[model samples]
Target: MYSFKSRIRYSEVNERKTLDLSSVINYFQDCSTFHSEDTGNGIDYLTSQNRVWLLNSWQIIVYRYPVLFETIKVSTNPYSFKSMFGYRNFMIQDENDAVCVVADSKWIYLNSDTLRPVRVAESDIASYGLGEKIPMDYKQGNIILPEQRVSKEPFPVVPANIDTNHHVNNGQYIKMAENYLPDQFSIRQMRAEYRSAATLGDVIYPEVALTDTSCTVCLASENKKPYAIIEFIS
Candidate 1:
């Protein structure tokens, strides 16, 4: 498992001094910075060399929440890695080893130069081994296609949502989904599938479907064209 110590920041906690959902997700991501080198070369350097790692999905479960000013340990290990795609598991815990959060992830190997998926080599796989292997069985959420949902409200894409690629940034989807989720659901996990890209000045109609335990949300263009997808788990 990959591990590091933590110092919970005030900005990351809520009124209860506990971590917020977005902050939880962000810190969880920070725990898994998987660049090719520890020699000060960053992700951009690896991607610039045409060896990018694409994240496909994640299933995070939260138990005890971490509070501001608390010291914790964060760690992760490769889950099930094979071929073009790999999987991993992660956790955040107190010094006593009491887990505060858990996350399972699916990742894909991308040829930076070709922009295509590629198989992982055995030697490359060996570098990530942490120790024990969990069961190969992993929980995966099906990517809800954009066309599947029925519309509720229509909104235009604005300049604020646009990012470097001139497309609606991925985090914008979280903002949009936040509006549709129930107040009771703490939103422990979010699994999203990127189907189409949304650019600035585009209008999108968001659609949602609700179930007892889960909710499916999506943002699409006019005539029911799809832009983004989100699935919420309790």
Candidate 2:
């Protein structure tokens, strides 16, 4: 497993002074990139080869949200790889070694030049020493929306929303969904399914369904086809 230690910055916390979902997502994102770089398969190497990694899905469970200035250890490792897809697990632990968050993510290797997924070299996979064990045994399940939503908000993708991929970053989707949630609700767990990419100038309609303990948010087009579906459990 590849590991790193860091403190929760004040800017990364919400009004409650606790880590937010978006920041949690960012931690996992950064740690994976760090791991790749440490193993000699970093972004520079991939870019040189005209390839990139794209997130496919995320399922994260938060047992406790760390507060500002709290030190935490973040770690990740590849658990499975097949064809063009890779499966990895991440965890955030407190100073006392108690787990604060656990996550499982799916990713696809893409040929940047062709914008299509390509098989990852077996030798590359061997270097990571991929294992069969999955942390938290977290499964990203299907998110079923209610027949009728409680609210809807429409917004355009701005230039700032675009990432290196020239599309909206995956973490932005989680932030968007969190914004639509009630202020009293705290996300204990979240699952996001990225169906399609949204680019600058594209307008997305976010529809939300609320329950006593959960909220389901779908980022869709005006015609109702979805780009992403996110579920938050309090």
Top lDDT prediction, candidate number: 2
Question: Which regions of candidate 2 fall more than 4 Å away from where they truly are?
Answer: none
Write one digit per residue (lDDT tens) for candidate 2, span 1-234.
888999999899999999988999999999999998888888898899899989999989999999999999998989989899999999999999999999998999899988899998986666677756555756646778788796565999998778888889999988888888897898988999988889998899988888899999999877878889999999
Question: TM-scores for all candidates?
Answer: 0.76, 0.94
Predicted structure 1: clash tally: 1
Best by TM-score: 2
Least accurate 10 contiguous residues by lDDT in model 1: 33-42
Clashes of each: 1, 0
lDDT of each: 0.70, 0.88
> In model 1, what is the error at residue 167, expressed in angstroms?
6.6
Clashing pairs in 1: 50-112
